[model samples]
Target: MARLADYFIVVGYDHEKPGSGEGLGKIIQRFPQKDWDDTPFPQGIELFCQPGGWQLSRERKQPTFFVVVLTDIDSDRHYCSCLTFYEAEINLQGTKKEEIEGEAKVSGLIQPAEVFAPKSLVLVSRLYYPEIFRACLGLIYTVYVDSLNVSLESLIANLCACLVPAAGGSQKLFSLGAGDRQLIQTPLHDSLPITGTSVALLFQQLGMSFLPFSMSSCRSL
Candidate 1:
C-alpha cells in the first residue's frame, strides 16, 4: 500500500474503451459521497470532469485545475479548514485564503454552515488528448482502489475501479491486499495481480497494522 500523504491523485481515461475516445460527454458525474458516521446525503455534489480547473500553471503545464479538499469535519481527518471549497469564489481573484474561507457561509456554492458542504471536488479535462486523459484517470485509479471506503457507494466505486484501465484500452490496473502480499500483474489472468489474495487476507494484513482507514483523511485523487 502507498503511504498516506497530504494529497493523493489518480488519473484515467473515462473513455469506456482503450485508445478510442467514446462517452466523452459523460464526463460530468455525481459521486455518491458520504458524511461522518457513514450516512448518505441526497444533495450529492457534482463533479466537473473537464472543468476549467485542469489548466496547469507555468511551473506545471497540463490543465487548468481548481482547488478543493473536503475532509470529515467530525473526524480527526479534518486537517485544515473544511471551508477550503470557498476557493471557488469566482467573483474574487487574488483574495486571501482566510477571507474566502470566512465568507464561505454566504458564497452560495455551499451552505453558510460548515457541515453542509460537499465531500470533495472532482477535477476533469477533455478527451481531445486521449492518452493524457487516460494517464490522469489511471493515476486517480491507483489511490481510489487502494484506500478503504467510507460508504457502500465508495466501496462499489473501488470495485469498479479495478476494471478501469490506465486508459480506455490500457492493460495497466492496480491490485490491493494485505501489507504482507506482493503486487505482480499476471497477463494470463488479465486482471489486477495479487499473491493468491482474498478479502480475509486483506483484513488479516490490515487489522494488525496501526494505520486506521480514517487516517487516510481526505483523498483528492
Candidate 2:
C-alpha cells in the first residue's frame, strides 16, 4: 500500500532559549520513526520551520502557515513540508523545560506549550504536488482547532489517512490501528479534480467569508 505521508512532526518554540539553535525548539512528537528513511529530518529544518523565531509584538500578526521544499541529496528524493503555525494560550506554572522534555521522552505526549510560545505542526511527504497540501492546511487546522475529540497523534493519523483514497473493494487502505474509521477527504493524486464549490466549502470551513487575494493572488503566481 502507498503511504500518504513520510513524517509528521510537532515543533514548538522553547521559551527558555534565545537563539534558533538545535535547542531553540523541541520536537514534541513524531510518528512511525522506525519506518523513517536513512535521511535525518529537522536537522536543518529550523531555518525553514521557524523563520524569525517567535514574535513578541502584539500589533503585527505573524504568518500562520508556509511550505518548505527541499531535495534529499543522499536519496535524491524531493520532499514537501506543510507547516501550519498556531499560537495558543497555555498555562504553564513552574514547568521546567527539562521536565517537558522528559515527559515527551517518556510518554510521547506534549505536556504543555513551552512557556506559551507558538507551535508549528508539520507534515512531510514525497507527494509531487505541494499546493494540494497547502490548500488543505487551513481547513485541516480549522477542524483541528474546533474539535475537542481529536488529539495531536490522531490528527496526524487522520491527516495521513486523508492523503489516501477511501477503502473499497480491491483498495487496501493504510491502517493506523486495528479497527477502521472514517477519514476526511483530501486530494492526494494529481488526477483528482478540485472544484470551485469545493474551494468555497473549504473557505467556509475556515470561517472566511471570501478569499483574501492579498496573501494568494493568481496574478502573483
Candidate 3:
C-alpha cells in the first residue's frame, strides 16, 4: 500500500484523466447558479484538472477547468446561506460484459447553532468518489476474472471508514470496532488541520492500508 502523501499525489494525477475532465465538465454544466447580493459567502467554486507538475502560481498556465455554483434556495431571506452540491463521475475501463452503476447519497445536517448563529440549517451532500471509482474498476476487473466480491466489499468498507473521524478516542466520534479493534478513540484535535498523512497513519495503526486510486488518464472537460 502507498502512504497517504503518495495517495494524494496519485489522486491529484488521477484528476487529470480524460474521463475525469468529462465528468467535471458535466458537473459544472449541471451546477445550479443564482445571483448573489454582495455577501461574504463565495458565489461558487471552480475545479480544474491541471497537467502533472503544474504550478498554481504560474502565469497564464491554462489548466483544465470546472465550476460549481452555490445558490440560496430561498433568495428572499438575507440570512439564509446557500447549499452546495458536489458532482463528479468515474469511468471504469476493462472487458466487463455488463455495466454496473452504484449510486449512494449521504447527507449531513448541521444546526445553525453549530455555526454560531440562531436557527440556521446546513446540509452537506457528498458522493463517495473512491468507492464509486473502485466499483467501476472492479467491474472492469471482473471482465478479466480478476475481481472478487470480498475485495470490492473491503474496498467500499475502507472508503466508508475513511469518512470517520481520524482520532484515537472521542465519545462524539463513531467507533468501528469494540475493545482492541477500536480504531478511533478520540475526537480529531484539529478537524481541518488533520493531514492526509495523519489519516493514513491512523488507519495504519488500525491494521489497514491504502493504495492509490490513480486518475492520471482523466482529462478536463
TM-score for each of the candidates? 0.20, 0.51, 0.19
Clashes of each: 26, 0, 17
Query: Given candidate 2, what's the lDDT at residue 24?
Result: 67
**Tens digit of per-residue lDDT, candidate 2, span 59-102:** 32453666677667565554556454546555444244433454
Candidate 3, run of 10 with poorest lDDT: 2-11
Cα distance off (Å), candidate 3, residue 32: 19
lDDT of 1 by residue, 73-142 (tens): 4542211111112111122223333326554643334223211111222422111222323333333434
Q: Which candidate achieves the best TM-score against the true structure?
A: 2
Question: What overall lDDT goes with each candidate model?
Answer: 0.28, 0.52, 0.25
- Look at candidate 3 and tell me the lDDT of residue 102: 69
Candidates 1 and 2: which is better by TM-score?
Answer: 2
Model 3 RMSD in Å is 22.8
Clashing pairs in 2: none
